[model samples]
Target: MAATSHPINLEVDNETLAGTLLAPQQRMPGVLFVHGWGGSQARDMQRGRHIAGLGCVCLTFDMRGHEKTLQYRQSVTREQNLQDILAAYDRLIQHPATDPERIAVIGTSYGGYLAAILTALRPVRWLAMRVPALYWDEQWDTPKQQLERARLMEYRNSRVAPETNRALSACAAFSGDVLIVESEHDEHVPHATIMSYRAAFQRSHSMTHRIIDGADHSLSSERCQQAYTDILTSWVSEMVIGDRIGHLN
Candidate 1:
């Protein structure tokens, strides 16, 4: 029989390539994105997609009073909205590709407040909050829309203790990585509100704080929106990649 020339070149393969091929498939991390009150999942879709590209299972859902549930906006209570968050978290963790142990939650404004409380009820490895809003604990069962806006603003302007607030209390007990982003000129969530959150994460494994210069509460300008997105994605990337590397090593 005549000898045939081999089409494959085994000599070109490297140890790194071989190792990668032999490595076991890892379960992906799960990420849950919670949009602020008056916002819907649409706002977080892009960010979720970007993070999903980094090998995570990302989920974004509207709370009870938003989007499809707009009819409930006038009557939705904080308790009901919290239930929405818990349901979303459960759905994400139940995803087939998710690594339940390495879950992350990213929330903005009112959403951030609920995300913090979520940690107390579930397992969260990383948390990212942008202009997390603070509210009094007394009105837990009251309809969110019925709350006094001026009262909320005044409360947010003052310093709050971890022991006195449900969200802050949860933050006080969290031992995972955290990223707190603040808008330099946010009218809805003042600097004091951010400071209160920052101080509450006393036991976090690591905490990063960033201020988007000249950004307002709503991020009305495109520049401000982009800045916030950049800061959030960068932090999430570092945390997710570092955690994966640690697991592999």
Candidate 2:
């Protein structure tokens, strides 16, 4: 997969945020890639490459507490990031190359949390979440410990309850199939925690979950990463194929 990235910043309530746009060698669809807590990184960049390789455009943006947003926020919370995501979603939907009906949102950790919160808002065709930070449900610890758990690979069961419940309350209003790929040994979000969120919603008449055994929150294993890519591609395929069928019908 070959991709060239361009740096750009977008405006949200007067603050300019940082981001990168990745276009594939071949054009296919559009993907909005959101980073975890710290913002941009090799992992996110690689994800962009993979999405671009699949012929999709990838856009990654910084939230308020992200490197760019950090300097601007008086305090941070999931609610605050939700607004940023709302803006980001709007921006992507309006981009010249993006077909609002064909766009998908992929978020990691905190970004995943944002994606969950926004799924209720519109035609989000598919969702791919990696080591989603259940911070809202779990105890808030040093960012270091959380990152460590995510990087060292401790995902097992989801204990991410508080936020998941909120996300659950908002999900029925969302329209689309959802996919969540979490770690099996993750310390940050024990499997039980995330499942609590699921308990509230009916399984997608068509949805699946895969556990990256022994993997932690970050989904750091090369094999797991590949699995993640496959899941995302397959979901995208479903989205496109389903849309085609809907249009024809």
Top model number, TM-score: 1
Worst 10 residues of 2 by lDDT: 137-146
Cα-lDDT of candidate 2: 0.65
Clashes within 3 Å, all models in order:
0, 24
Per-candidate Cα RMSD to the true structure, in Å, reads 12.6, 5.1
Candidate no. 2 TM-score: 0.76
For model 2, residues 1-249, the per-residue Cα lDDT tens digits are 577788877787677777777875554467887778765545666767766766677787778776755764445655556766787777766656566776778887777766866777756767767766543434332333333455323432444333345565544444456667778777566666567545544644445566777778776688877877777777766766676677799
The segments of candidate 2 whose C-alpha lies over 4 angstroms from its true place after superposition are 1-4, 24-28, 39-41, 72-74, 135-164, 203-205, 241-249
In order, candidate lDDTs are 0.82, 0.65
Best by lDDT: 1
